[model samples]
Target: MSWANILKQYEQEFKEAEVNSYTELPDGKYTVKVETARLKESKNQGIPMLAWEFVVVDGEYEGRHEWKYSLIMPERMQWLKQDLFSAGLELEELHRLEEELPSLLDRLLEIKIETKMSKNGKEYRNVYIQKVVDRTPSQKPENPFSPNNPFADDGKPINISDDDLPF
Candidate 1:
């Protein structure tokens, strides 16, 4: 098909209504689920760190995400240990961190998130997982990204096949 003809056919489809982007949640204590947790290197300090992405599961900012990073090296182990303890993991040894941290994904916890201004006077937010909450006997945790999950509505997981692409 000619480029002009293709463009003409899809012109109306491309003019669909605009969707609003997610805004930062207000600074407060909220219940959140661990959306993603992984070990990553710090770009500035060149140290290994545990990076976590948490999603609010309730209230007005239900689907918003917040990030938290805990440095895992010897010099920063104290803070790292505290964060782990707050997340319901009590570890006295550094070696066990790597083996157990990944299991925290999808776990729900109450967290205190605060917004603060940096040295440059720009505002940003930080999340601190305060405590891990236990699920009721009849309830089970669900993945927000799963097809059947209730929170997956606005942020639906798209599955695009290779053949569906134009190029």
Candidate 2:
């Protein structure tokens, strides 16, 4: 294929792409899937850190990306452990966690995003891993009020008169 033909393939995407891809997403909770996670040096002082990339799984902002960086140090171990465990990863050693980082990719997770202003008056977004979201098919009914639900609160079927509803 010629250079002109290769560029034409991405013509639609180029038109739709944002002017800058670094813009931060708004603060809110989101369901996302881990797209990338790896150990890398911090930009400021070259300290070791784990960097992550997550893409919103579904919602108005679907496909929007966010990042979370966890500094690898003794003091940060508690929070780091919480985040890792929330993503369904538990390890006895940090090295083992690093080795198993790949397992986090493609896992569904609930994340909370907050925007904060720094002392320098610059705003930044903080992403927290709230919990792992199970997307697998389960035996439980998706709707609690659906008829004949085996896991209903009572053995009897739920029946309600129109007058019972507040409307």
| Superposition error at 27 for model 2 (Å) | 0.7
Whose lDDT is greatest here? 2
Error of 1 at 142 (Å): 14
Off by over 4 Å in 2: 1-22, 118-122, 135-167
Evaluated at residue 85, the lDDT of candidate 1 is: 88
Best by TM-score: 1
lDDT against the true structure, each candidate: 0.81, 0.84
- Which residue pairs collide, candidate 2? none
Model 2 lDDT, full chain set: 0.84
Q: What lDDT tens digits, residue by residue, belong to model 1 across residues 12-104?
A: 877995778767777899998888778889998878899989888889888888888988778887778888888887877767777887668
